[model samples]
Target: MALIQTSLIWVAYAVAVVLLLIIATVFVFIYQTPRDRAVSVTTVCIFTMSALLATVLLMPVDIALVSSTSNSAEGRKKDWATPNEIDSIIKTLKIVYYTLYSLDALLCLLVVPFTYFYYEEYDEEATEVGDQTLGTRLWGAFKYTIAFIILVVAIFLIGFFVPYAKQAKNDGRLDLDYFQRLLLQNRGERALSFALGLLMTLGTIIYVLYTGAGLALLPVALIKSAPTVSAPTLAANTASQLEENRERQRQLDGRNEGRENGLESRDRRELEALIREERTLIRRERLAAESSGEDRHWLIKAWIKVEAVFRPLKLIGGLLLLLLALFVFVSMFITAVDKAKNSICGAHCGYILGYLNIFQPINYIFVKSSKVFPIDYILFLLLVLFLFSASVVGIATVGIRFLWITVFKIRKGHTSPQALLMATVMLTLITLAINYSVAMLVAPQYATFGHQTFCDRAPRHPGEQPDCTHNHKAIRPCTEMSKNAVAKDVCTPSVLSTFINGVTIDFPFFGLIMFWAQFAFLGVYLVVFVATLFKTPKMDEDQLDADLEEDEEEGLLASTGKRFGATWQDITGHARTPNYGAAETNGERA
Candidate 1:
């Protein structure tokens, strides 16, 4: 029965993987809007979905492996995958997991960086089309590949192996094999643990802030979605925008240097994009100003008037959402800190197999309150709702500053292929880091499935799993088996635990580096959030005006890419041409 089940799971997994890839490709190539936004967001969403699909598909088999041998647990033994059929199932899933993981990693690492540089427009007449040979294009990809490889190597050397290698000999790690030595080293893990804690702390901060924004806006967004309830909008100063567009065109022409003047390249692509966005904003504002609601029927006109009188409800609802977002975020963070401060875990523990833990206090409260008010249900509901909302906001949030730093984020509403690829690279790192952070945030619920705690499991025989659980209680920590040595009463790893451990897969160092880089983003999000508080956002300039479709995050690293464009233009003194060519009075840009 289990063998057939496993085969069915594999079949389903295959079908799902193909379907997901096709869907992602369709979204990217056919249906994407605001092209750069699609590139950045879809990359993360598709990869995350694929990871989740694998974990979910394997879960039933994992549960079956730990099923009780007898119907009743009075004298029954845990299956623990002891049967040959179960073992075969485990093997099948392992192969399936790694196969998908390898493909995902290949796409993220080798293919993404190569495309980032290789895929660019070339002018047919820039150099008589002679310089635009296959060799030149391949050279571009090769340089990017080599540079990316060098960066990865340097990160490992500096962040993990180099410092640890120096101390390895001093700690008599010479006695261990290379793999054992690296894995067994305590000093580096201490560094990594602290790094992980700091990262969770900062990620929580950004997460809560955006969630708050989403929740706050959600009320207004609901209101705006109505047929006649939209608040009046102010038109932009487009006369100035026209002047700005003219200046941009003049500057774009300056960068049309040499024979590339009218030929395709970065300059022309950018100028057209930038101008296109300016024109769009100008056109939108002009249309808004011209189209008054005077033509509406008497009933609709009356409805709008009545809705305006109730505008304060949106404000009240917005505040409640802000509070809810903060409450959820704080609960999740506290859970992590509580795990870090556990009697077994304490200051210097990574918890066996590097499990990120849960919100103990909140759980206890929910359990106690569950009997009275179904608080547990409410908690779960809030978590799902707010996290879903946060994910929506997060995709559009200007949190990935690598894109803002390395590539200038001109507010073009479209990206050149190179910019799109760069966004993908930045988003790949984000998907990994944010996934881990989110796993940690929700670990308590997911990791404790069908068990009390992740650490309260069967004891390891000496060097099996780390006693980062501290060998507390001396006796095995489970409920099913109280007698026989043969009794396999231990908890099987949870779906979350399996994914967390397997997510990083072969490269442990990559996890550490990705984490710390995310930590640095703490400051970026903090400044951005703080600025939002200090200055009223255009999105919220009027009454009840938030929308999910818009990227409302702002400040120096605004999601709209306003500040980035301003800063670049100021620094370069309005460069000759744009980032890509499209022949827009190209000679004057620079």
Candidate 2:
């Protein structure tokens, strides 16, 4: 029986993991698509709505489980004498069941219908492209609405009426045990039936309201606007606008080319004069320089000084950014660990710890004992240390490179190859550290619970165990059982441990991959920066003058045209902007 139970549980867990992975991959693919902004926004809105519905339904279940375990009777039968635990549990169950029914009704009757309408509106313009007539689309929508309403009503009936009727079957005679009767007569049963009925009636009313609203609004909109322009009129208008734009563009291009030609002519003349002057100076200095044996040493000294100052500053800035990135990564890692610990270690250490182990496969190995390692904090510290070490190495490399370039007056661009090598080394170190950290954090959490021995022994059967040893003495098993039996007996643990372990296993590796990917981007940027620095420099004055002239020409062209053009005035016979009509002239004498 235990083997069967464990196998089934494992199968369910595997199925869930596969489903989640598929869902995540699908979403990632959708997000990567180059869809238009409106389509992407609509997709995100729908996804968010679905996620919210799922979260709302699942959160209640989680709460019920936690509440039930926390308030369970000491012995299984102890809760039989006091009805409150059973009553509270039944109440919670009913609330959860009804909430699910309400959500189903909402999705089918409200969200689905609303989504259909929204899609219809969005696709209205595209209907003609696919040769789909408006009447056909409307008919399809009507059929969908009817089907959706039927499904919602069916779900409501099945979810509420089945449970209610089953309770009625068990309770009508009042011959069963106290617990059975209590379950049959609970308030939750009544609530579910009532809510289900209300939802069905409400959904019908809403459908009627939607039809009436659509009828009233459609004609008003149609009356306020004439039938849209025919195809021929649209085509003619588009062609005419295209022609007008072409003409305007031709005129603008002509003016630009003429201005460019004039600038070129002036530049050519200036260049010729500068060349002649350079030749004249060369001729005058050639004889004297040849005789004196003088050299231009100052220029080389100045270039070396400029390179010295700039190199250190660049290295320092790069190191600072790298360190900041590492710090952020470490902080996020620590926060994840702390959250996992708090979630796993609730108020009752022994019970909660056992519950957590159910989800973590590693707990199976250690389930026989109570002794557990403080692995969560240790994993967190190791991650921090790895990130800190990487940061230190990065800072040190930057400092060493700075010293080599500035103090040593190394040849221009000579330190770049060394810098690249250091970056590669840092990248490798960080990658390995991150991998090790992730492995340490994730692998141990999944290990079997083989380390703890005390937990292995069975408590003497309930009646033989000491009263003081049990926390909930009122519970049947604890009050009546021998210590040996109670210790040996095992109950199913909570699945929360699996969830936390799964997160630890997946997130760190994924984070490390992302970190390395980001480093690749930084490396590419650095390579580009180095290339730019080593490339030939251009004369600044000529580039500045050309930029200024381009700006001036753009400004002139922009100011030359009215936004709406002359045709707009001719058609409207008035300007769009406010105008104080010349003070209405009246014959002053009159």
The top-ranked prediction according to TM-score is 1
In model 2, the runs with Cα more than 4 Å from the true position are: 1-93, 108-110, 121-143, 155-590
Q: What would the per-residue lDDT of candidate 2 be over residues 377-474, giving only the tens digit for each residue?
A: 23333333334333323322223233235221111122222222232222223333232223222223222111211122333575432343354433
Against the unseen true structure, what C-alpha lDDT does each candidate score?
A: 0.40, 0.32
| Model 1 Cα shift for residue 514 (angstroms) | 9.0
Q: After aligning candidate 1 to the native by TM-score, how far in Å is the CA of 271 from where it should be?
A: 31
**Ten-residue stretch with the least lDDT total in model 2:** 346-355
All-Cα superposition RMSD per candidate? 15.7, 27.6
Q: List clash counts for every candidate, in order.
A: 31, 44
